[model samples]
Target: MEADMSAGDLDRRVQFRRVTRMNTALGQEETWADLGSPVWASRRDVSDGEKAAAGGVFSTVSARFQIRSSTFSRGITAKDMLTCDGREWEIVGIKEIGRRDRIEITATARTDR
Candidate 1:
């Protein structure tokens, strides 16, 4: 789906974050660090699905975020995660729209931390 990226639709503030792993004496410690200042984005819930694993069903929610293209947004990758409204979304894909006018981020809701 194409996002119009209108000003009103970009109503939510989202922050991009990356995970940093450090090797410690005992083990590896991973931490999430902010990439840049929060930016306005248009967030939409795309779909929800259930995954069956280990004799259980797990629910996952997918979402799409549209943000204006910039230096920071252009550098984003699938390894990055987005935080919005106190929820973390794992980035699944990144696509540039219309000569880099905007970027569409596809992500899945992460409840396992």
Candidate 2:
């Protein structure tokens, strides 16, 4: 199905950065590179999952972002990060809308702390 992304639908502006891993002498280091300009998107909290494991409880908050595909290239993948409202989120999943007209990004942030 196609996503209806009218001007009023996109109420938030978010920036996307591609995550690149470089192998250093010590270990693998991740670097964030700006993909393009900030794009208008509709953001919402998708779900929150928590579980008691080992010593403490593990919790994660998943968020969803809907953006026009034209705003970005097809290079965006799960190895990217989204910055919204001064918070950094790691992209966990991505869904392309019909005909690549829009994209739905599912990201998560640790909330255990």
Candidate 3:
């Protein structure tokens, strides 16, 4: 038996995109193309990690998104990106729950280089 998803759990709308790479004569090009329509997902802050070594200090903001399994397919991977609340997040990890009933995506905010 599988658990049902609560409507209240999915409150935020997020857009998913797959990263596409193309090889050209000059070099490689990458683009983000929409995978499908926007879907409702539950968002939460997972963790905050910091590292201070011999080099400069580094910090990471991690977040999790729970969505219907049907919303995303196997094509979605760590190279993908999610857009929510006018911000873009890079997908770092993905986990399938309860026989693909739902999916949990771990991501970090996309920072400008």
* Deviating ranges (above 4 Å) for candidate 1: 1-4, 110-113
Better of 1 and 3 by lDDT: 1
Error of 3 at 58 (Å): 7.6
lDDT of 1 by residue, 4-70 (tens): 6789989999998999998999899999999989999998898988888899877888999999999
- Residue 28 lDDT, candidate 3, scale 0-100: 96
Best by lDDT: 1
The Cα local distance difference test for each model comes to: 0.89, 0.83, 0.82
Candidate 2: C-alpha RMSD after superposition: 2.8
Residues 1-113 of candidate 2 have per-residue lDDT tens digits of 55367989889999989877899999999888878898899988989999787988888889989888874546788878888887788998898887877888999977755
Better of 1 and 2 by lDDT: 1
lDDT of 3 by residue, 1-113 (tens): 76677999899999988878899998999888888888999999978777675886666667999898873455578878999888788898999878878888999873331
Clashing pairs in 1: none
Off by over 4 Å in 2: 1-3, 21-29, 51-58
Worst 10 residues of 1 by lDDT: 104-113
